[model samples]
Structure formats: structure tokens, C-alpha cells
Target: MLPADDREIDLKTLKFVQYYIELGLQAFDDWSNFNVVDQFQTASLRYQLYEIVYSLATYQAVYAPSLRGKVCEAMRNSIEKSLTPKVMGYWKWESLLGKWSLDWDPIKKDNIMVSGYMLKALALYTGNTGDMRYTEPDSLPFQVTKNAVYKHDIHSINKYVLRNWDDSNFCIFPCEPNWNYTACNVIAAAGSVGYDRVFNQRNFERRRERFLKHLKEDMCDESGTLLPIKSTFTGFTIPGILGPVGESVSAVDTAFIDVPTSARVWSVIKHENIELDPKSGNYKLKGLSGADFIDMGSYMPSTGAAFLSFAFLANEYGDYEISENLIKQADEVESPIEELPTGSLRNKGISVWVGGFGLRARLIRFRDWTNTVVNGPPKQCINGPVLDGYDFQNVLVAKAYSPNGEDLELVLYNGRSAGSFSLRLAQLAPNASYKVSNGASFVADQNGTGIISVKLDGRTEVFTEKVQKV
Candidate 1:
């Protein structure tokens, strides 16, 4: 088993995670209330769903490997929400102006914004949990209307994304009809890499060279700065004045598949957009205009959102000093967090979409994002003891995993009122005697399942290891 100190999670960070978990549990049914309003697409339902699933999946991969059910459900809900007419039917309007016909099927054409995120979520769910439910035929159904339904699943989505890449003259396709975005394509590329990782396929590998070549040549300017948008019909590329926002987002996405390019792009962003604040002795964003300051979610000026993005990128690249400094800058300007009944917290000033970025920045370790995408979760965590069917509302799980695929470790907090709760443990050695941290011992049944009781007043840590025979 790993040392106890290695698995320790502090109370503040625990609550931060609880916040996203609680949000994810409710994301399936009621995502509209989480600030799902935007002039652009940032704060839309689909985007919010993507952010929520992304946050929850990351948490599952790193901290709570036992929470696979919750993450999978959230991913399903996100795919369902993305297929809704209101969320994806915008393609109808875009198709009118473009060469394609009005097809309500969102993923069949050039909407990488919808398809990319959905692919990422599905890939993450399957990769982390090893669940193959999404791979079934017509598992993801898009109901355009009462009679018009489009059948799709994980395989179909992957095929469509690859096909779109193959068909596009730019090699990187568009999010809307003709508007190509570097950030969105990066998301799609990362999703493709994720899919390949899970299925042991080289779909992305075959197209990797051309994708990178076009991404660098067609989407970037003379200085190698990533441009935000390009028009396929006119072949017009937007300038990189919004480099801070675009580069930061792309840095996180690109790191999943291509670490070297990600590092190089991040170096440029740091040199151009970041500076040392001599007054506070912290790193802060520099050379931002009003356009750059606008939060993509709310379309309002928010220095905090910008800071959060930079912090997220910094964290992804293992720049802890820059990440911590930028997070402090965000906290200084962002609204105070409100505690929820379940011991979770939320910021009323920022949209939930933006808040998702904050959660990622806080929880993600250096290369955790890339590692999760490229390698999936650790194999030991997948095959080891799992805490299933725990009381999510009352017991806040901080860390729950098996370090060596044989032992169990958990750190939990009282989410609400202090009380005793029961946790179901699965995947143990069958009928084996085990020692518990709470001065107790139990033997697993023939089916390799057992229940352990935990009393949570504030924080509780538990460890269960098999009793080695002489």
C-alpha cells in the first residue's frame, strides 16, 4: 500500500471537489439553472454539460476511482443534452448559408464544437472506467423531432470526426458551418487521441502528421501565435490579438496528444501574456484588451475568468508558481464562494461554466490532464478495491483508491450532519480476511464484497489491507 501521507487530501480541497461532484450529480436532470445563458455558445447547455463532465471525470481519474458510476451517468447526460434540438439545432441556421442541407443530426457534418466535446466525454468515461456501453450501436440517439431521430454511438462519433478531418481542406474542420476555431479543433484532436487510447486503435495516428502540419501552418500566424478563428469559404484567418484566451485553452487540449507542441505554445503565451506583479510579488496577466477581458461564458468583462484560464494552463504544464499566482489573482477579483448544504461551494458572481475552469485548475496536478487523456486512469485503481454505493450527500469522498490493486485507502469528510455511514467495498480477494484501520477486521464473502461502517464527524480516513498469511 502507498504511504498515508501520499494520499492525504486537505479539507479545503475536499470541499472544492465536493462542489463539483454535487453539481455533477444534479447535472443530468437540471443543468439549466447553472447560469445557462450566453450571447455566444460558451454558457449554453452543451458547454455547461461538457465542463461538468470534464470536471467530474478528472476528479474520478485522480481522486475517487470508485465514483465511476456517477461520472458515467454524468457523461451520458451530457451526451443526451448535446443531442437536444435546442442545444445543437443551431446547425440548421448555419446550414442554410453553407453548401450543406439542414440536417438536425449534429455530428454528421462540421459541428466539431458539439461532436468534439461529446467524444471527449464519452472517451473519458470509457477510458477511465473501462465501460463499453457507449460502444453499442445506436447507444447515443439524437432525436431531432418526434419522427426524425439520428442513431449514433461511440464508434460512429469517432468515425465521423475522422471523416470530417479527412474531408476538410484545412485538415482541421470547423465548429460551426464555416468558422474554424483552433481551440475547438484541438478539443476534437484530443478527443480523437482519447478514443484511440481506449480502443487501442490508430485512427488519430494515421492523421496525426497532417493534422499537426495544418494546425501549425493554416491556423497560426507568422509568429506561430494561434489564431482564434478562420473562415473555410473565404479562407480568411483572424489575427491572434486574443492569443491569451485561445492559446491558454489550446495549451490544455494539445498537451493531451502532443506535449512538445503544447510546451512550445505555452512558452509563447507565458512570454507574451504573463508578467510579474511587483506590487504583490505574484504573476499576473498582461497586454489584455477589453475584448480579451470578456468572459466567454457571460460575454462580460471578467478579469477572474482570464486568470482562471491562465492558471489552468499553467497547472497543466507543471508551472506551479505561475498557476498559484494566477489563482490568487483570480480569487482577489472573483466573487466570494457560498457554502452549500452538502458542504460544497459555488461562486454566484461567475457562471458555472467559468467555475468549471477554476475547479480543473485547482484539482489538476502537473500533467494530470495529459496523463488521464493519454494513459487513462492508473491500472491499479481500476482493478483494485472500490468504494461503491456510498452516501454521496452525507459523506464527502476525498480520496478512495487501491494503491497496489490489493489494498484500499479512503479519506472522507462529513458533507452534512455528522453520522455513521456504510460503504460497500467491491473487487476484493474472495473470502479473504482483511484488517481495517478502525481496529476492526472482516472477511470478504465468496463474491468478494463487504461493507464497512464509517463515522464521520469531520474528517475520516480508512485503510483496508489483506491479512498476509505466514
Candidate 2:
């Protein structure tokens, strides 16, 4: 039964690999932009670039034709210089930021924790070159050339800290701030290489306990029905549904209100010490611990993500679906189901790909606001302009004309597309259903543009544009 015609398949795979590499090279002008800063966002990006090149360097036996010398040059110029001891050891400076010169700022202000995922990119990309050293301040080099890798100060996946900003509830990021997913990839991404210990101390045991306690107490009702809680991410304080964050604060404590999540709930179930109850379904961990659950007017995009991630979490924890109405709630958007993303599509109709599974979770607020004040009088307002009454999670493609007559655009970011389809629309001419199709394939490829068949063999194409309406 073991057929020996594997050559054809192997050849086909090799061709596809070659084609993909060619696409990257073509997009970058034969890899000319190797040293460019465009790709530099986190140490992770550089690390990934280098890792791709390094893999090509060693595995060229099969794909050697695609790994050009320019690629190697770019890799060397961008990442190799950052491996020195002083740069690596400095806790305040994440060497990965060398590309942008932004210096190393932790995702959150209080903790020494940097991202573990970033550290992994560095180790994988630089480990074999014997470039990393004991540069971290006060600590010795992680290694001398040819020395075995040691337990250096790196990041961990399951990191938690006590509530900062003077709050009663304690909260933690599954790994660190932003990227949220309490899954196995985090564990592997933290310990993939032979070495284990990184800069951040092991925080899993404690975080696990607190999370379970919060789930039991805040995420359920008196009868044990589950409530959608997201207090840790958003940082609103009441009921700890969101935790106390900048947005969590209002103009004044007395007149303040918790931010609202686009999601809703009809029933409240009780679990074991779920500290806070975010009535609004905000994305905070500790804040949700304090508030009582709200009955959903209906399913909302903002809350849909909570249900998705939490449902998966439940399944991971051994709970199986009994009735399956959760799916109906998740897929029920006003638009035709196939064309409408789960409120997570960007104006570009693009999905987020976080952790390793590439699921869209962390939504980006392109404008950095912490630098300025957000609330109160103009003179007192310092945080960059906090988004005004905007819920990023539920937008798909909203364009209300601005006062000046230009289109003000908004799009969804609540979740990501996870299939093999597309939705093609020629124009937004109303009184009609735009062309629709499955969007999974394009999403998985991280692509956002394509052609669509409108009728029997009839189709049209459109490029996603982040444009203002005229």
C-alpha cells in the first residue's frame, strides 16, 4: 500500500516554497530592503526576519535558490549588532527596539516584564550565531561564544502582577499585556528552545490560582451560568469587569461611567470568587471582578470575542457544549453571515493574527494616547486624544460624513476571520446586498485583496483601502 511516487509531491511542494519565497523577494526588490526599518516594530520582527534567513542559510539544500545573499546581508545589518552584552542585559532597554530607536518600553508601566515572544525571536534568530551575551544589567552574560545557553533573564508566557493604580483586585496578562490567550502555544513559545529560564520569574502557579478563583466568583451567576467577563484587558474598575485603567477612569470618580462592550448577556451565572463583575463587558481582568453581570440586550461584537475565547477556554478546561446556542449568538450579525466577519474585520477587512494560532485578538489603536491627557479641561488633557465614544471591536465598515464633508471611516476589530472565503463588493451603492463569499483563505494568508465572482462566472475585484469618503 506504500506507493513510491513521492517525488512528484515533493517537487510540487518545493516549487510552491520557491514561489512563496520569490513573492517575498519580489515585494522587497530582491530583498534590497533587508536593512529597512519598515519591518522593525518589536525585537520579534527582526528576530523573525533573521530566523527566516537563518533557516534558509542552513536548509538551503532544498530552497537554496530562494535564499539570496542580499537576504543574508539585510539580516546581518539589522539584528547582528544588537547581540552585545550591555544592550541585552539592560532591563530598561529592549534591544529589539534598535530598529525604531524607541528604546524598550514594557507593554505595561509597572512591571519589569517585557514580552517573552520577543525574547524567543531573539534566541531563535541569534542563538546559533553565538551572538547573545550576558549584557543584561547586573547579570552575567547568558553565554560566552560556544558556551551552553543558560537561564538568562527573558520573558515568560503566564505572567501576572498585583493590581496597579491602587485597586483591590489582582490581574495578569496570560503572558504579558496585549496579546491574550491562555493556551499551550504560550507555554511552548516561552520554552521552545532547549533553555528554559528567562528574565521574568515563573508566574504560572500563582496566576493560575487567581484566574480560576476569579472565574469561579465573577464569571458565573448564582446558579452557575457563565457570564462574559473581560476586566483584565480593558482596565475599567467597577465590578472589576475591566480593571482600573486610564479609560476605566471617568472625568471624575463620582460622575464616571464604565466603558461599554458591544456584547450583551441575558443570564448571570455564578462561579467560585469571581472578584469583579464588569456590567459593561469591558476588557479588564480585575475590574470585571467587582461588578454584577448584565443581561445582554443581544449579542454584540465586543462581547462576542469574550464568548469565543472563554468558550474555548471552557472546552480546554473540560466543558463540552450542551445546547450550542452560543454559535447562533456568535454568528448573528445584522449583515449576511458569510460576508460579515465576526465584528473583527478591519476597514481593510483584515483580521488580527496573534500568539501562534494566528487568531485575531489584540486590536490596535493606531494613535498612541498615553503621551497626553485624555479627559478633563484642554489644558489638563495630556494623553493623546482618547478615541471619542468609539468601540473598535464592532466596526466592519462605517463611514459617516465628517463636518467638512469627508468620510470618517471606522471598521471592526473585535475578532478575526478563520476560514477559506471572501466577500467582494464593487461599491457601497445602497438598497442591495453586496456580493458575498467565504473569506477564510485570504485571511489565513494575511492577504486582504482579491477578486470575486458576482454571478454565474461573473465577478469583480476591489482593493481594500483605508480611505476617507469624498
Candidate 3:
């Protein structure tokens, strides 16, 4: 495990990660076959399922394989069952035997947003597992039975974007009757990249570049934020369904789609207007698409979504200070183990989505130590507590165990200014003499807990070492 290193991190971060993972898994389990559409009188099950699947795939991509294996297995199994002939052919919703099925007509299909999300999830799964079954020419959703014939290949999901490209160089299909969404267009554009990556084809780069140009030059406002919705026929900005939050909210009012999309396509549409709040230190974006409702706040969850999203992006770009502050603020609203609703957002509730964002936050905060890359190494952990202390906020952490399991390796990243701090370690050998790699002093208690004192003299100090038993 990386030669038993010592690192510093906020212990609360680990707790939050565990909390969000539990919350997400519980929500998925409670869905019990995702039959909530009939149970809750909601028609947005397709989008909801996509969110759940993406989050699940993220879990699989980031966490330790041993810890996340069973969960990922279950998710993959459910995905195969969820796909039907009708769903494979057309993205529509149908009613079957008192249950709602995602077998709608062509006109009723969810916009390219849903299509993009589904494609992304599948692509990520394929990338992670190196599974080529999805890339075959006649695979139902896309006929991959033939080896070399590209004609009539429905599995060429990339065609979904190419065929629907408008003169504006972006997709603008009607998600509902006449309303098209800008967020959907952008997501579909990003999905084109995933499509190419999965199939090893090169049909989307030019289209993607043109769409990105349209966004930078025409779609953004004075502050450089993309307008949330537009008309399909007229190619004009219009107030419409914001995103997966549903039609009850305006696209311009919520951060749901904008923040997540920013994380996915930051290279193309980096938003400079999303600023950090001076008072709370939370990165706040002003926009609310839907009316305030129970379980889902108009601004709270959306704000949290934006923070978590930025945290993910910051981690990717190696901006740990931004990532840490964003993660802390996100924890305030989207805690790991809050009481979440089990049913759909339009009818029963949407606490699960909040938890989904929380899960993403945890993934971002700990990515320095976890499998941040989709095709990176598997999950690895040290034998003892990686972190067990609190004081002077804003830091990242990682840990590993000695092969003999007699000692712990720790790594602490102080992302803030210089300061003195207290650290606690849990689950170690009780009342044992210990040696710190940094020449610090500490002792374990009867309960196997230990405390260490640290003095950081700079804004960016990474403390790493092997804490051996004496």
C-alpha cells in the first residue's frame, strides 16, 4: 500500500463518506426494483434512475474494489433487467400491468439529456470493466450482431447526437412537447465524448467542438453562465423545465443541471461567476428554477449541489483549497446521514438526490487517496485509523497499513494557513507505545484510540509517515 505512508486528513470527511454511501445504497434498496413511478404517480422515473445509476457507477469507480464490489455487482445486474426491447428502441414511458415502464413513444421520449446520461453510465461501466459487449454492432439498443456492418447499427448510440444536431451546432430536441433545454444540449454534447471513448470511434469531435463554440459565443450571459433553457424550433432562450428537478421549476433558477454539467464539461464551459460566499465561505450561485417545496428546498439543495460539483472539479484540477472549502460547505447542507425520502421527487420526495450529491462530495474530498481516475488502481486502505483528530479546518488525507498490520501509515494535507492542530486516531492497539514518523508523540488508550499533536507552519504542508508500534 504505497510503502506505508503517513498523511493528515479531517476525520469527519471519512464519516461523511460512509454516511452518504449508506444513504445512497439504502435509497436504491428501498426503491425495490424502481417501481416508484406507479407507486408515486410520477413520470420522471427515467431521469431518477439515471441519476441513481450514475452515482452508483461513480461509487464503483472511486471506492475500494473489495468494499464496493457487491454493490457494483448488484447495480450491473439491475441495469440489465431494467433495459427492455421498447426502452432499447425508443426512450419512452409505458404503463404495464399497473406498473409504469420506460417504454414511451418517440415523441414522448425524454430529451437528449436522458439519452446522454444513460450513455455516460454505460460508457463508464464499459471503461471500468473493459467490457466490449456494449460496443458490439447489433446489441439490441444498437444492433451489434454483425461484425463490420455499420449500417442500421442501432448500437451506434453516438448517432443519437449526430442525427439530432441542429443548425446551431447543438442538440435541441423537445423533452416535453415544445420545450427544449440548454442543460440537456450541453450534457448530450459531453456524452458525445463518452460515446467515442466507448466505441473507439471518431465521429463526434467536430460536432462537440462546434457546440462548445456556440455555448461560449452565443449561449452564455454577461457573467458567462449558460442560459438554462431554449426553444427547439426558434433556437431562442426560453424559460422551460430546468432539468431533472422537474417542470415545476424554471431551468434558470436551479443549479441541479448546471453545476453537475460544469463538473462534467469544465474544459469546455468553465464558469467564472460561481463565487465563494464571503460570510459562509460557501461557493454560491444565484439561480432557482423551481418553487420551494418540502424535502427539497429551492436554494439549499441546489447550492449544495453546486459546491459538491465544484469540489469534484477542484479535486480533478488539483485545487485542494477550493475542494476542501467546497466540501466543508457542502457538508453543512447535504450531510451524510440525513433523513431522506424514498419515493419520487414530484410526488413522494427527493432526499435521495441530495444524498447522491453528498456521495459525490465524499468522492471528491478523498479522491487524493482513492481511485479518482476511472481506470486507476483498486481501493486500498491501511489497517488502523487513517485519521481521528479535529482542529483547524481545511485539509485532505490518506492512509495505509503496514503489511504485518502492526502499525499504520498516515498522510495529512494541510490546505489552510499555518496552524497548530490536534489529531485523534481510532481502532489501534490499546495502550501500546507508538512511534511517529514526523517525530511527534502520542499514546493509545484502553479503547485503542490515540491522540497526536501537529504544528503546521505553512499553507501547503503534506505530513506523511509510518506510525509503528514500539
Best by lDDT: 1
Model 3: weakest 10-residue lDDT segment is 247-256
> Which stretch of 10 consecutive residues in model 1 shows the poorest summed lDDT?
1-10
Off by over 4 Å in 1: 1-8, 27-29, 38-40, 69-71, 96-100, 239-241, 430-432, 445-447, 468-470
Tell me model 1's lDDT, rounded to 2 decimals.
0.76
Against the hidden true structure, what lDDT does model 2 obtain? 0.25
**Candidate 2 lDDT trough over 10 residues, lowest sum:** 363-372
Q: lDDT per residue, candidate 2, 1-470, as tens digits?
A: 01011101122222222222222233322333122222222222333333333222222211121112232333343233333322234433333332233333332222212233334333332332222342343232231122322233322211212222123253323322332222212222222221222222333333434544543354344643333233454633233333221111111110111111101111111132112334733222222332222211111123333333333222222233411222223334311123223221111111111110101111101110110011111211111111122212221111111111111111112113222222332123123222222221121111222233211111212223223221
Clash total of candidate 3 = 34
Error of 2 at 422 (Å): 44
| Residue range 1-470, candidate 3, lDDT tens digits | 11223322244443333333333344323544233432112223444454455555554444322122333444454344334332232232222221254334221243454455456556655644444665656552321122211222224555655666643334445444344565555545445555565456656655555655565555555655456655555766754423223321222111222334344344322244246678876565434344212223222334455555445545544566766776666555444223224211111222444344444545543333123222232323323333444431333333323323455544444433456666666556777767665676566788877677666553233232335444
What is the TM-score of candidate 3?
0.53
Which stretches in model 2 have alpha-carbon errors above 4 Å?
1-104, 107-114, 126-171, 174-229, 233-470
Q: Write out the backbone clash pairs for model 1.
A: none
RMSD of 1: 2.9
Q: Comparing candidate 2 with candidate 3, which one achieves the higher TM-score? A: 3
Give the alpha-carbon lDDT of every model: 0.76, 0.25, 0.43
Which number leads on TM-score?
1
TM-score of 1: 0.92
By TM-score, the better pick of 1 and 3 is: 1
